[model samples]
Target: MNQPTHPAGGDVQPQDPPAAYPPYQPPAMPPRPCGIKTWQIVSITIAGAVVAIVVIIIGVIALSGSMNRVAKEAKDYYDSKAEPYTNPAERKTYTNDTISFGYPSSLQEMSLEGWNYTVRKGTVSDRRVFGDKDMNYFVVYTQIKDDGHPAGMSKLQMKSEMSSLFDQAQSSGSGLTDVLRHEQLICQKHESNDFSDLTASTGEIADGTPVVSFHYVCDSRVENEDSKIETYQSTWYDHKGRLNTITVSANAKAKNKYGRDSINIPGLTARLR
Candidate 1:
């Protein structure tokens, strides 16, 4: 090493600091595209959540209405299929000159010990008074002992008598439900049914005899504007010249709305033997 004289006679000329060393750096990695930003992804998720909530609410409302309609339909179906108003446990047997059958004990014997409401020749010998919890009731009259028409009444007259007797008391209402409510009816032709036989004169045939029956409906609106309906049905039959009569009544509104029909036609006829 050759010793060199400093310029200006001092170390000021020591020289520029050593060239700056290059800055250190880590090794590079593979380049990648930026994915969705955090903020954008969060916003998208929140919007989706809101949309899902809205859909759930709409679905709930629709489901609720459908459930209500289904429930109502089920109730109406069951009501239509239910049994009649008569109590089945209390059965009573009765003997009549022309026929015999059982009836619900809930019916009260109408004629008393002294009062004999007798229509000669099965006109109206024995009767039972029956009503429902609503005080709606019916009367069953049968001929016993005195078989055949009244002494002087002809067969045609007797048949007419049986046919028209119970009908006179029937009243009019919405759909003709009330018995005492009097309204013109849309009468149907007498037809054979499970409960009664068909005949030329009327609806009833008793022990092969041509009896009489009339089934008609009254206009429910004729009675009360708000009343739904009033139902009235009657049947008459004869045995050995004796008569068997049955009357049934119902309130249509009460029955459909509250399932409270008090009439039981099948029960009354079941007693016929």
Candidate 2:
């Protein structure tokens, strides 16, 4: 028993120094994939929805504004034609020692808004309208107003000079649109005396013969405005020693219904004193 100790080396020998712990290696982990997270995707979706809603609301407001503008335009057009003519006091007969014209107070005022209407420019020296609130219709009467004749110029000289001026007006290219571009033919060789008061002019009855200008002038609806063009058989013109013209005004739809003779312009001309 005393010798049992003899087998073990008097004291325990130290184990090899712990092997330096291998520099603390951590477990390898795989890299995360490169992309948006679920929360990020949800945020983007919400943002897109907000933008779409805003766009839709803006579109609706714009459409409403456009509709309102169209309505106002129609109302103004209608009022311009209807209101003034409504009151008996608003309309009056035109009379002069040499000529008298205008609708009788007894007759109801007419307008395209109410029904198709006709206004005969039927005067040698005047212009009028049935429903053209824009005053698109006009009559131009010219008589050698100083015909380029000098105080002492001979009759032949005066006539020659005047002729030159007249030609200038006929072919004036400075500010005139080529009428052929806007003119749409409706009638030709129309009867005269039907829409002219020229027969009563002081000089040559201006009505060289009975003929009316062709029907249908294509023009804008508003005064001094150049949009929304429509054509109607509401215009007439002739030279009876004087230039007579009757301009008709109506919307496109109305023109289809009313026609060029809605006002009996010819009858009006013949009726005027």
Candidate 3:
């Protein structure tokens, strides 16, 4: 190669600077989608939830069967250990006799001097014998026994008996003649349903005898005011299957000739439980 001559002042012009080279750069690739990883996570979460639900349902079905078995076993155990109230034959006889005549063997003797209570056999020929030609009325008394000792008589029974009396009152004319004839019609129909939803309860009687004295509502609706009346009732019972006291009363609005008067039981409070 021939050497080039330099100018007297300096070396030959510097060789042209090497042509400028472009900066080094890495190759570019297309960007990935935004949520590919997110979609994968969601799909896995949904699959896990479905599996968990199936497991829980299976567990509940199994548990239900076990619960049913437990309930049946408990019922069977209780039934097996239960005791009877009384012998079947004796019970049937007692129920029949008591319901028929208000006579319970548990009560040795019962008497209500002013109650106008009576028992008569055969059907009542005349309706409205008890002053309820339009409405049904009856009165019944049943003795409840707790150990040869009487617990208390049911006031419900008195309501039933009175209903019977009302029916008897319908047919016969009032006065001494009708009063004498009242004893024979105990269960005559003109059926009445009297209930005493206990409004107030008085404490037990002094005799340590169980007594349920309460105020009740009497639902008596007869056509004629003179014939039959209905309103509030207060009843008392002793432990001897005898009704110790009874008062049929009414509010100011129930203005019937027969108003508030305590029934005359003479000395019934003496017989407490």
Candidate 4:
């Protein structure tokens, strides 16, 4: 159908000329995929978890094994160190005849578990004990006993007589009983029949008296070792040229996990010289 045309400048203006046709254009779209999908992300997370678990488990096992090794090594070291002290056969060289040093007839010849005795002059006899825990020895002057009666007597009989005499001497006017009790703390609970036979030195005390010292362990209840130490000094001397040893043993276990030697020795010069 034909339609009337209107002037371009008309007030109502003719309907806008038909819109000029434009070239066809495609709709906007996102870039093609270059990243992980949801499933891929989940798979990566699962793989990381498995690797982490394996590493943790391996680390724990390694640490446990290391601790066990350290414990075993420590046990072995202590066992080896305790071996020498436990063996009774290990003997220390010593003079059997204490008389050579001008000790009194009351002194005796005896052998201990860890000592070697070489008698020079006086005859030695061994004393019997209720158990092997105690070391009891008696040394008697055979030259003074006269008339063959004393000489003919058996060692056991001589020891018995000498022991009686010693008991009497200890209990007699001499203050041996008080000395023993006073020195009890030095020995803890153990007592020795002979103090002269022990090793002696000049310790820290100002007194020039000879100092005797030894090492011992408490009954198993305290520790399974000979870890205690003791020291004694000459308290009194008799007109008869006798020395009464007053002694004490000190303990370091209160401060130490194991124990320390009773004597704080600086060097062999002090001990040997």
Question: Which predicted model would earn the best lDDT?
Answer: 1
Task: State the displacement of the C-alpha of residue 87, model 1, in Å, after optimal TM-score superposition.
Answer: 6.6
Model 2 is weakest, by summed lDDT over 10 consecutive residues, at 196-205
Task: Give the lDDT of residue 138 in candidate 2.
Answer: 22
List lDDT for all candidates, in order.
0.44, 0.35, 0.35, 0.34
Query: If ranked by lDDT, best first, what sequence of candidates would result?
Result: 1, 2, 3, 4
Sorted by TM-score (best first), the order is: 1, 4, 2, 3
TM-score of 2: 0.28
Q: Work out the TM-score per prediction.
A: 0.33, 0.28, 0.23, 0.32
Cα lDDT, model 3, residue 64: 97
lDDT of 1 by residue, 18-60 (tens): 7688778888987887888999999999999999999999999
Better of 1 and 2 by lDDT: 1
lDDT agreement of model 3 with the native: 0.35
lDDT at position 146, candidate 1: 62
Off by over 4 Å in 2: 1-209, 221-241, 253-260, 270-273
Task: Give the per-residue lDDT digits (tens) of candidate 3, residues 154-266.
Answer: 54553443344344433333421222232222212222233234233333333333333333333333233333333222233333443332222232233322223311111
Give the runs in model 4 whose Cα sits over 4 Å from its true position: 1-32, 84-273
What is candidate 3's TM-score against the reference? 0.23
